[model samples]
Target: MPRAPRTRRSKYRALSSLALLALAAGAVTACSDNDSASDHSASSSAPSSASPGTGKVAKAKLHMVDNGGHRLAFYVTRGSASTIVLDSGGGEYSSQWKDIAPKLHTATGATVITYDRAGLGKSDVVPGPWKVESAVSDLKAGLGQLGVTKDVTLVSHSQAGEIANCLAKDNPEMLSGAVLVDANLPQFFTDEEIPRLVAATQPEVDAAKKDPEKPENRQLISTAEGFAAAHKAFHEVTWPNSVPATVLVSEKTPFAGSPEDAQRWRDAAASFAQEAPNRTLVTAKGTSHEVPTERPDVVLKAIEDMFAAQH
Candidate 1:
């Protein structure tokens, strides 16, 4: 396919940067030595013979797999229970879970996996917009490459929650459960609302672009156009009622907006939970949209709650 014109590409890049910045600040940063961060997994737990689904966290191995031409980096903390796969928010790297994953592993005693999607962290970037379907495919391909094909629990934050939803819908049998943290629910967004949503998040994008040296400027995991595309795609997704899920609603909103805006955020989260047959909503009283970072405890508890509900 022909690439978009340079002028269009620039516009998409600008919007994508804004969308990402608004939804998740500090997501785009210069790539670092993957070993420096993933090394934390080695200290998390030791390898054990516990069988899958036994809730035993063993030492995890770091993996850097080639997803087609792009790299997908992840840390697999081995355990005996259903593996918990952590999916970060839009443009956020797996390191967003750094403060949470180790503690979560220790607490749940289940294998935990956190990874950088196609273009984040140390992974390679792809062409054009980031599609929701493509993101789901990458997760499956990345997991399959690691020899993980079943008994998986998906824990996703923010925008990635949309990807997790599609994963559960398409492969209900593969998932043990799902945990959504302040996830985006396109079902709740109307055509009129999208532009408003985009507009609301534009300031952050503008701020990032205003300063070209900002690391986030280079973080090209998902463009605003990609996010908008995913939002539309999510509307067509049908999450299986058979998949146990836990949706966490942060008390704070993404931007410092009116109380009504915050309420709408909460409502959207609540609506997502209501749609699930086997799901519950847990409101984190003192955190913002950066649930995984600001309130790892809540994220951990929500995952634990989902596991308990399923088992």
Candidate 2:
């Protein structure tokens, strides 16, 4: 394949101005979560203020499903060919897939849909100390409730890697393929292996449980909550899903990692290929963590590549 075009620095430069934008947007329009190795501090150029479920994103068609007695909120962006159900990261719900899913739908002629976990977005936050299985159950029950049939594709980002993996492992019949965008690989970094990463997220979690609706407390809660959600999400994820998988990972290692970490990430992607043989691991250069926002076109190509390869 040829080299992917570099995104202009100015595109990412606006990250600095996002916090004020986030606070003003009235809390959220997307969803996010974190892992042990995930970043805690806002980069000088990261968009700290992009709310996951508010403002322009509020118009997203909300859907509900029953999971273990709790009603979960999920959203779908309708398209007309095949359907793609995307899982957003921790601290994030269905709203994070807002722009990118639509793009994928248009480019590939697929219907892209995303939704929130139990308490993450428009859904009610229930009791029982959420676990990774809850997420898996949510996906299963949600799809069943929505009347989504077999032969679907899974598109996920960050912590959502677990959701996609769980589906592929238990119910291989539902999938045509899987797309992992900056995904998690427990074989490389497990729950116990990322304690420091977990510790950094407690503050953010506490802040969200304390006040998810406050604008002044945004900085205090965002990172920690995101990390806590992701840490919980990591336990259920695994490799060897039966269908062909596409792993889209970032080339840059900003911190909490080394050059070898990228190598490890690729090696994990390589492992996915080893299992499926048809799995394609594409590296989106000049990015880490937030590939969909940092460089969507690169992510877009990987989707096209995998879908094409399957045909």
Provide the overall lDDT of each model, using Cα atoms, as 2-decimal numbers: 0.63, 0.54
Error of 2 at 142 (Å): 1.6
For each candidate in turn, the TM-score is 0.76, 0.66
Residue 69 in model 1: lDDT? 58
- Locate the minimum summed-lDDT window of 10 residues in model 2: 15-24
Question: For candidate 2, what is the total of clashing residue pairs?
Answer: 21
138-216 in candidate 2: lDDT tens per residue?
7777666656667577887766675666567667787888888877654444444345444533444454457655422
lDDT of 1 by residue, 1-311 (tens): 12335643444334332333222123231111111111111123322333345554355566777655566777787665567898887656776777667666776667788888766676667654555656776788777776678888888877676677667777788898888887765554545455666776566456545664433443432345444434444455567888888888778756435575567667777877788568888888887666676677778788887766666
Misplaced by over 4 Å in model 1 are 1-58, 203-215, 226-230
| Regions more than 4 Å wrong, model 2 | 1-60, 190-192, 195-238, 253-263
